[model samples]
Target: MIHHAGLIAAFMDGGWRGALIQGPSGAGKSDLALRCLDSGFALVADDRVELWTSGGRLYGRAPETLAGRIEVRGIDVLPAPALAWARVSLCVRAGTPERIPEPAFTDDFGLRLPLLTLALLESSAPAKLSRALRHLGERR
Candidate 1:
């Protein structure tokens, strides 16, 4: 089991999959999620997500209490479309990463996943994430 300070968003083009978005509190985790949703991603978990490894792949799910809900910053909690689980294909760190090292990887529940970083507040972030997902899907 792995509890992380992040939210997970699942996107489906032909298959359902997800990315684990991690960062310090107020790092715009949920805000990034909202943008992703607008850009065609679905929520897997918000604020807190439960992660586990299954047959060598990492999966993410929302805790029961947080299911289908997301905090919109100063806005009230809102109901959103959500998936019970999804195989995590990547991990996204929301921040001004000092410097992006060469290909990065992060471990969760004993599984390693490709990691990427982005400035979540940027207007183009959601579009950037969507493109990254498309690129990843093509590679896999």
Candidate 2:
């Protein structure tokens, strides 16, 4: 299924793990993704993501027309280095995250992914996400 979301992939363990960012328009999905990119993450998809199950794992990618392009609001849609696809390891919802969030997960194609609610525009968001991914890796 294709969703209105931005996908960014962080290289880990010799491969890429995707973080699917979901939110309403102008909710900082793209902005957060841009920050993630600045922090060494790769863009998997922008604006729209095509998700599917392969060998029981959920994966996602950009649609053909939008591949390698990221929208910078009030700026041009610029080209960037991107991955063809990534195995989704986390799901981030743009919102006011709880100070101490309990364990949460979201299901896609019957696969469950760790969920993190974030205030996307925060200066520390990308760092928080990186830390969360590291914690997630430790648990797996």
Query: What does candidate 1's lDDT look like per residue over 18-128, in tens digits?
Result: 878888888888898988888778898888888777888888888899889988989888999898898888788886754545766776457667777889888988887
* lDDT values, one for every candidate: 0.78, 0.89
- TM-scores, all models, native as reference: 0.87, 0.95
Where does model 1 exceed 4 Å of error?
10-13, 97-101, 137-140
Model 1: which residue pairs collide?
Answer: none
**Which residue pairs collide, candidate 2?**
none
lDDT of 2 by residue, 14-37 (tens): 888788899999999999999999
Q: Estimate the overall C-alpha local distance difference test score of candidate 2.
A: 0.89
Per-structure clash totals for the candidates: 0, 0
**Backbone clashes (count) for model 2:** 0
